[model samples]
Target: MTTTSVNQDKPLPGKPGVAPTFRWAILTLSLSMLLPALSTSIVNVALPSMAEGFSASFQQVQWIVLAYLLAISILIVGVGRLGDIAGRRRLLLAGIAVFTAATFLSGVAPTLWLLIAARAAQGLGAASMMALSMAFVAETVPPSRIGRAMGLLGTMSAVGTALGPSLGGVLIAGFGWRAIFFVTAPLGLLTFVLARRYLPADGPTQKVGRLGFDYVGMLLLALTLGAYLLAVTLEHGVFGTLSLALLLAAVVGLGLFVLVERRATSPLVRLANFRVPVLSAGLAMSAVVSTVMMTTLVVGPFHLSRALGVQTALIGLVMSAGPVVAALTGVPAGRMVDRLGAQRVVFVGLIGMVVGSISMSLVPVSFGIAGYVTSLVVITASYALFQTANNTTVMTGIRADQRGVISGMLNLSRNLGLLTGASVMGAVFAFASGATDITTAASADVATGTRWAFAVAAALITVALGVAVGSRNRSSSDRHD
Candidate 1:
């Protein structure tokens, strides 16, 4: 396989390589990243109010998030393939439009089902943008600056993640739960308009050739993910009858997807890409990184509020520390990755995570907030280093044309990790607490649960570190290295 780098020197806008308007392109992509990132965490604050307003159960309220995640997981690859066929810019514009519309619908939705459906639509739009934004970053930036550009993506996401809960709380308190969705509609619209005005056209330099898409592969892929996520998210444990059936469906669908791809003229995914050690290693480590990250994100709030007896506002502030540190560290971390290489940066990150997770696990009730905050900062900083560097590695690992699919696969890994974290951590928490209903658990019980969860997260991070070390010697042979 052959590959070419975009020119380092600036070129005319709308032409290939680094365009003069590339800064605005980055701004556009940042907004795209922010919107989706904010959407993921923001709505949780409004779930209770939404349940009250709609007269729905807590389980039904969860579907608001579940629906969005499921849609993204299911459709990301197909939309990504569509981008490679139709054009990244075109798909991006369409996605912004769809997301904006869905946001509007969500704000005005009268019924729970309608709201869930709209969230699903929002997820579809988010998937398109998520898959294409990194590809656009790669196409529009020089190879030397790619790490910095990727850092900006991480920065925007960190900012969004940091602000989401506070913003959601404000909206829910001042207006209603509807305002959570309504408030972001303008960002989506602005992104769409700016993209239309400033984003470069898909010129001949990166023009994709064939239009044929593998429908069978796409269907099988969707079935596999949809079933798997459904199984994971459902009330049943992994061994339960319904979960077992769905897992079985996922297995069969995956097998069929592989078989279909072997025969398809224009396959949705390049099956051979999996053989690349760097990409595979990066993806695997990424899943572990996300799982450990989400464990803290999921369990920390309850631990703060219940175990540490922190106030609601203060809990938000303490939680915000993680993303704040992440935002500040991202750019510098990117520069380090560029200078020393992703393997080295990733090792530093894994070490931080291991230490941070261990520290958090050992935090006794007697420990002050300062200790907790320090641990959070270290853990978030680790992700800042790992995420930006690993993303740079994986995106650059593939041929330029394959970025769309690879990005989708990357996001899929992230979502899967998050789902795993939510389920596994919740189960662990319940077990440690000695009750399924942790909401009313004693402070000591909550503390025990939180410690156990962090311990498990630490173990997971250690495993990921081992994998990264094993792959370190193989990095040089990987195509993009």
Candidate 2:
């Protein structure tokens, strides 16, 4: 390559200084991360408004959210691999442009199905952004400061999740539902410009031993995940005949995926790489931790209103506390991972989760919002620590060429956890409450259900703790042997 081309492809200076170009590049990456998260969250508050606008039922309007999530879930791993083969910087810019245009379409679409289609297109763009943005961190930041970079991305994600509802409410109330989409469109455009101008150019694709992409594996896995998500999320988390059939298809698709991956010349995923202790453990614990985190979101609002008699209007305020804590703690947690090492920090984070979970299980309704919020703060803060530590450990531990796919896998695991928690945790809460219709259940019963559900959450985290410790010990033994 020419010297100019080489210079163009090189990432920022490895010193991790406060250079203007480097800062701008980070901002570009941050916006890429923020946009998808913002899309995921900002739309929820607008769902009712959208239903009214389209003259659609609530069930139909919900497809707006599901379609977006479904596309992203199915596309993430595939796009990540495509980025690896084609070029990260090139594909990311394309993703940004697509996302921006899709945002515009979402704002102006006259039909509900067209709006849903736009959201799915947005998801395709989001999958690229979500997968490759993390891969870029390793390229852009100094090796020593990667933890901080990961933490910043995590913070941006939390902020997006936290900021969405309030922002959407204001926009909808003032300018209508379309305004919510319109507001983010310009931000998306700015991200596209910054990325194209400031982010590093794509280097030549690295040729691994494998010469072709495994298209079949990608298809099968996408099908598997799509089916599983639909099964778990549909019908208000109720597992019925359709859910059963979907779950069956998911399992069968997974089996076929493994078989196809094992046979592929250039596998979409190298199945053997999973034997790497750190990577496997990290992904597993990420899913488990995410599941536990989702429990707070699923259970908290109900517990607040039903058990503590908090007004319906104020429930959102209480729910925001955990995400706020997560946003605040994300950067600091990343710094801690840098100084203390990921292994130690992982344990500390999980231990905090365990304590917080136990607290949630025991806090009496008599103690009110103060008690619930305090426990929640602990869980979320700990989650921030765990996420930062876990992500840094997983991403930095992998090979450069594999970073894109692994990042996808990592994010996919978290998504799966959230999906599982939304259904399974909700089920546990219902089962604990002993109510077929939780909305109509007695307050004391709801409180009892809260206790039991969190106790289950605590158990799940303990299992994750075991995974962390076991992985560490296994790594040590492997080295010694």
Candidate 3:
């Protein structure tokens, strides 16, 4: 198979010489991806323990997760662009090193504030990994094997995400909450060593016109997202006035970011790309998919453990089924995308998700274990299909020069979706429970909240389906033209 150079001016870093070790390189890089992905969910099970240990409020405990997500969402696109310019391998290695150090700090954090700070640092590292890992796979693997490689990567990511909670629960149950961070330290170190030894060095230097970092635009974008996230965090609190103010600030900041990007020499997001219906719809669908799936992930365990009196480990096992199916289905989904085009595959997947959400919503509080597992399997399969197809659509629609930027935006869309979904689900759960403590009314509140959340998510998926249909028709028209 011939390997085409995406950038002919510079020799590709991982050429045929590097091909022999390609599999190992992919494996090591995947470990870097897995660590961050796992950390996102693993910490959730430990939140209660963390709160008690530090005498922190629920809001404070939430920041531990939110801070990391917000950082990743805002910075991923910018950093991914940098990786394309500077070298993916360099950024990936640096990210791993920083993430490893942050994990250690989090493990020994004396206060909740420190842990939150560590998490934010960790997120920056995660952004680097998430942005470059795909680009590396695209660059290193031959076209004939790209689909399979992507499928495997997607599967690993799914498994990592699904395993986090159960693994964390077991670790916390046996050792302590700190073990959650400690456990990944060695893995991170090993990955770093392998990356340094096997990963090729290649940073392409292209003379991009008026190339300069858009510092002001980046700051505004960060502030905008930060304010919006802060407002969401204050949803059920006495700080409504502050929340409103922050939300307003976020809107203003976002407007300024758009204006700045329009005039800036080097913008973080390429505004012109959205002109393509496929790109626009694909991103929108990706966001909706994240919101829906994350809501299920966040609320499912709470409902299972509190409402049904299931243990955390057992809940994790049940929840794992969805991602497990998703992991297994990703390759087939990618293959289908290759053969059938992303639009049809994504539409079908969205429909499946709608079906899954409806099924989950209808599940009774007393649903048997088998029924619960069935619901999870359907949800997972739907998500896997949707995600793989959506990724193919967005990535393949753009020019090679823009892949890093678009990929970063894609990651941002996903992280933002998860952040928004978790917040919305939390608010719904809080509202449903009234003023009662979560522990006392765990079952009823969780079940009611989860049902409502799933229903809302289903409604969102319906909107995404409409968008997908429109995109498909538009693509057909373009082809005819």
Candidate 4:
């Protein structure tokens, strides 16, 4: 298969055979993707150490993770819209600066609350980075190489996820839990510099107030999202009275947000944009597919230990297989998208996920760790393909002015799916095991739960597949007519 660099479509004015500008720009964007993804998983491994150092409970320590998620979930789309209005490159630099400073602050914080506050700050930076990086790809990379650029971003993200746990383990063992936060500071600094030098400046035409900034709409949307996220995550994804109240709040907030947006001169999200068949389908598929992937992470450890009797020390190692596959598959999958076309590749990827999900649900315990890994690799690798194609299609299809918000929306869907998966899928696993707590389930029951959860996962993927198919048909019919 043929591949091209970012400048192939339209060469930079300055250099010949030395696409230094393009290379540096790609590197900057790549680091932007990596930092946020790394932060998402890196802090997880340090939770125990943090609790011990802070003299805190599991619930409190968990806030270290949730605080970050809450900030990102609530503000990612807002920041994305803000980027479009303010300037993506400018905000991205500010974001990196915040993230880098917060990283060091987290390491040095004397109190647990201070550390959590730092993390929330880091999440603000992460929200900017993740929301703008994909949008920037359209700005920097040539249209022909968009797939590869998307793939590279995906690969960086996967690498960050795969690297976080093991790297955190080493850092904790060698230097303590604080080292995990400190280690990425220099990387952030380097990313900031490269971005400042390499990325194109926002054009004069892109200034704020063509429609005016939609403050009311943005705030209402953020509150709505925050409420929904809290509702799903409170009580570990189970719904209770408070959860019900939060859900109701989310519903009311959403209604108000829509009303506000309709009246605003400019809105954070264009409610009418959902009418585009591909965009709507892409968001729905992204959410559901992400939920299915979360099943593997949520249940893999319990299934490995309780069902297969794998040692505790090796559980993380075994669980790393999916990300390992994802890291390896990202670039190649992007190439496939460039060659095969995004829609076809998306359909194929969904089909692959369906097969893998079924295999995950049915692989007998007798077949052991290898069987589980094989099925997981299948699903994970297919996800790499689907994600690359889906992102490429969405990012490339939209108007240039709207890329930032759309990019944020994409990230928001992914994050919401992950949060939902942790709660909903975790509950499904426990229910299938007939155990109040999954950790205490018997070996056979754990195995049974693993199978049942993946069966549900398979159904979720099947639905995503249907969405892709139905959307494609509608899009085609609309075009032909």
Candidate 5:
């Protein structure tokens, strides 16, 4: 290995500075975090409008959201690894540039397919952003204040998500749906400018001899997830046969990926980390929580419009409550985790989710929009608590060297869970209603399916509760040792 001089003109990693430029650098990185988080849910409220504009089916329109998520899901780990090998600042800047360009392309897309392609491009940029932002934070902040910094970052993410739908709806109503994409472009450009001016260049520059990128593992992982998600969307006949084949291919591909990772000199995901109980449990809870949260996002708007006859604009307003609660509660949850413990906070949050899910399930047709909104608020608040605690726990337990991989896997698990939730929940809704479109006679049937979905969500949260309890018990024993 060859050694290179560390840049003395730049701020040292983990050093505190009172300079205004350093503060601005942190703000730029934080905003970069905020944009992609916001983008995830912003398009969701506009799905119906997009469908009508393109003369597409509900399933086809869903690709606009799914494609971005799928792209991010597969690419985040690879991007994170690259950031480690290259430079975090370089990746962050490049990501911002690409994301800004993709946003413009999405705005100008004339067809649904083009829009989906643009979204996938946007996701590639997002992967770069998401992978590097956390690494930047860990690098910039002192160890003593890392928790506080992470809490603020988590809060910013929650606020961004909370604002997304409402902001999208307002833009769509005032100007046009395309403005939603356009709004992000300027923000991305500004984030890039700030990052370049303020962030120090501090990433790996020395070439580690014979270090290999896990190209095969990346390819197989993408195929596996893409195929499995496709299978969930298929209805019947030859399409079903193809879906089954894809599912099988995905399973085989995943098996190959594991073997490749095991043999690789530098693996994308370090399998050995699973031996740590905190890492394993925290990651598992993260997956389940992500699945539940995303399913609600997917189902909530449709439920509002089709079942309750709420206006599209108003639906965003109602949906905003959950993320708002999440944002508001995030800092407090972080503080609680720091003061009490991650396990106790997580256990309480999961229990809250169980209650919230049950409340949502009990909502009746006679209760109307007020009732629906109330139930949604509870569910959203519970989710916020769970997410804040889970994220803090996962990031806090890992070593600095492992943070990139852990963050990448943490995000991957969340997205995979979301993809699974959307497909399975959509399939369940279709089965219960016996129709793709929910209207008139199908309204009651749709509600039945939604209630069942909530019930299943409740059960999943209950399982999380058990896991949380067991984790707390283990932590106590470890402390005694």
Candidate 6:
């Protein structure tokens, strides 16, 4: 690459001796992250209310969440590529606009399907926002300041998570389910205005060609992701014929996507990103950690509601503990990453996850709420540690040019993990409890399922631990050699 090409990837330097643009830029990007992070947690409590409002089945109501995940996972890479070709600032502004509009649509959606569609659009917008924010922040801030900025972003995520369930409960109780969506509308608008006012404007983008983007590869990639998610959503312990067909379609679509990428002059995702040891290993660990974290997150409330006959209000209260602890831990974890390096910090985090998961798996029916809540705190704290360290590792390892798509890949691993956790844990729970309908099953059965699910979570976390340790050892060996 020429000097010009390399320089284009770097952030525009703040004017010397004037107001610090880096601080303002980090603030803008952090606020951008807050919206999507808030949205993810806030919507869960309102699902029941939404189901009641729309007179939808439990299974149908799940699409509200699944659709959002599917949309984000499928389009993130394509959108990130667009941001690379276009400008990150411009794409971020567009994302805010779309997200704000979609939030309004979600608030006013009359039918279940309409709400699902709106959520999907919202997810697309959220994807764009998330995919670029880290890259934008990292590029804008100086290398020395990167750790502090990442810590701040981690704090913002924790704040969003900490606030979500509590705020959702209040909104749902006071106004109705729609209020949950309505509250975020103004947040989106505020983010948009602040980002526009504060973010640095993009310079001229270098033109590639008449067909700058690999449209064929983009389409195939979308199909591949969409088909795989659909197959998971339709799974019935064992895959049904429809699920099997979808899975096969996903496999074929992936093959086609690879072929198209090889032929394309400008591909959506570069195969070379995976060659970076830290990037690849960090992403892999992220997926596994997310799988473990999300499995417990999904199953914990179920266990509480069923086994202990805990009320929804109490469950929400109990659920807030993890995020609150995570929020508190975020900055400290980032500092640790800065001091101890990502490998060592991530290793400790994975150990926490393993311990938490093992404790959860062993929780007896007689175990009180305190035990569950303690387990939650441990797992979430571990998440804070792992996420901050691993994210820093991935971002720092890649080139400035690769940051956009690497950000997308990071988020994609997470969403994929969430989907995997939900599906795998659900299937395991069902099989262990011998219940066809896991949701409305007997309390004893549900408790049994929760135990089995946490065992799986523990196993996943152990794998993450191995990955962390192996990477650390490899790096040390290389250094020694």
Task: Highest TM-score: give the candidate number.
Answer: 4
Question: How high is the CA lDDT of each candidate model?
Answer: 0.84, 0.89, 0.77, 0.88, 0.75, 0.80
* lDDT score, candidate 6, position 205: 75
Q: How many backbone clashes does candidate 5 have?
A: 0
Candidate 5 residue spans exceeding 4 A from truth: 1-22, 45-62, 109-114, 173-175, 233-239, 302-313, 363-367, 429-437, 442-444, 473-481
Model 6 residue 126 distance off true place after TM-score fit, in angstroms = 0.6
Across 298-323, the per-residue lDDT of candidate 1 in tens digits comes to: 88888888888898878878888988
Comparing 4 and 5 by TM-score, which wins?
A: 4
As for TM-score, the candidate ahead, 2 or 5, is 2
The ten-residue window of minimal lDDT in model 1 covers 1-10
Look at candidate 4 and tell me the lDDT of residue 135.
98
**lDDT winner, 1 or 4:** 4
Question: Deviation in angstroms for 426 in model 2?
Answer: 0.5
Which stretch of 10 consecutive residues in model 2 shows the poorest summed lDDT? 1-10
RMSD of 1: 4.1
User: Model 5: per-residue lDDT, tens digit, 418-448?
Assistant: 7667667656555665655555535677678
Predicted candidate 4 versus true structure: per-residue lDDT over 401-438, tens digit per residue: 79989999999999989988988998898888998777
Q: Model 3, residue 168: what's the lDDT?
A: 94
The TM-score obtained by model 6 is: 0.90
TM-score of each: 0.92, 0.95, 0.87, 0.96, 0.86, 0.90
CA lDDT for candidate 3: 0.77
Looking at model 3, report the run of 10 residues with the lowest lDDT sum.
1-10
Tens digits of lDDT, candidate 2, 40-136: 9899999999999999999999999999888888899988988888888888998988889999999999999999999999999999999999999
Instruction: Identify the superior model by lDDT, candidate 1 or candidate 5.
Output: 1
For each of the candidates, the C-alpha root-mean-square deviation to the true structure, in angstroms, is 4.1, 4.3, 4.2, 2.3, 5.5, 4.9
